[model samples]
Target: MNLNLRHAVISNVSGNNQGQLQDTIVDAIQSGEEKMLPGLGVLFEVIWQNADDQDKQEMLATLEQGLKK
Candidate 1:
């Protein structure tokens, strides 16, 4: 059997609107549970895929800054 994690994640959240998506993301993050990590990873993957060079650089810089702190 094969599983498509990204597609599955997207399908799961497909019905959500902007506010609900925000709530889902916020809830997953603030809960700080291991199980939520995969969902967050999938979300990040989507963001990274759609990001432009400047956006990607900014994201990397933000990550670097956060990591430094």
Candidate 2:
């Protein structure tokens, strides 16, 4: 079977409002389930691909800050 998880994940969340997207992210993080990691990673990949340079920099800064602790 051929599976494209990134495409599937993005499709699953397509058309979601900001609040709904936020809820999905928050729920996934709060659940702390290993399975959710892939979903989060797919979401991040989407974000990374579309983010502008400033946004990418901000994300990198946030990631660095997160790793510092």
lDDT tens per residue, model 1, 1-69: 124877888898988899999998999999999988888889888889999999999999999999998
Name the candidate that leads on lDDT: 2
lDDT of each: 0.89, 0.91
Model 1 residue 40 CA deviation in Å: 0.5
Model 2, 1-69: lDDT tens digits are 125887788899999999999999999999999989999998898899999999999999999999999
Per-candidate TM-scores read: 0.86, 0.90
Candidate 2 lDDT at 32 equals 94
Best by TM-score: 2
Residue pairs in clash, model 2? none
Whole-model lDDT for model 2 versus the true structure?
0.91
Given candidate 1, what's the lDDT at residue 3? 47
Which 10 consecutive positions of candidate 1 have the poorest summed lDDT? Answer: 1-10
